[model samples]
Target: MTDCGCDKAKAELEEYLHNELCSTDAEDIREHLAGCVDCESELHVGRVLTEAVQRACRETAPGDLRDQVLLKIRTIQATH
Candidate 1:
């Protein structure tokens, strides 16, 4: 339980876990997470969500949709 309750920090922490922040800002968030259990749990959930997304992506390539997108891109390139 932080003095301010860590809600804003948790939001920034999710971005930090995703590596979406600049280096210095990410380091600041990492340091905050190190000392805060609440923030750390939020960071862990973000990591788990990311891993799940990667696993799901690997399992399904959507070949038919991919081919359609590629064909559309080729047609646009040919036109331009």
Candidate 2:
């Protein structure tokens, strides 16, 4: 298996992180990352940022804010 090189690996890193790449492409990235410290570090950073974003997405709005937004939506719907 040839190393897919840093350019392709970095370009597809996000897709690889999200498991959106086909197996062949993912494998190429995996192999490249295995031998390349810079790409591996980049992958680590991507993992961290993804995790942070996931955590942020999982958080709910404060109760009062949620209620206010819902009320506004309902009012707009009522008028329309």
Question: Top lDDT: which candidate number?
Answer: 2
Which residue pairs collide in model 1, if any? none
- Per-model TM values vs. the true structure: 0.61, 0.81
lDDT of each: 0.76, 0.97
Q: Worst lDDT window (10 residues) for model 2?
A: 1-10
lDDT of 1 at 27: 71
Query: Over the full model, what C-alpha lDDT does candidate 1 score relative to the true structure?
Result: 0.76
lDDT of 1 by residue, 1-80 (tens): 33323665676766776688887777777677778887888878888998998898889558999899999999999999
Clashes of 2: 0
lDDT of 2 at 7: 98
lDDT of 2 by residue, 1-80 (tens): 57799999999999999999999999999999999999999999999999999999999999999999999999999999
lDDT of 2 at 44: 99
For residue 39, model 2's alpha carbon misses the true position, in angstroms, by 0.4
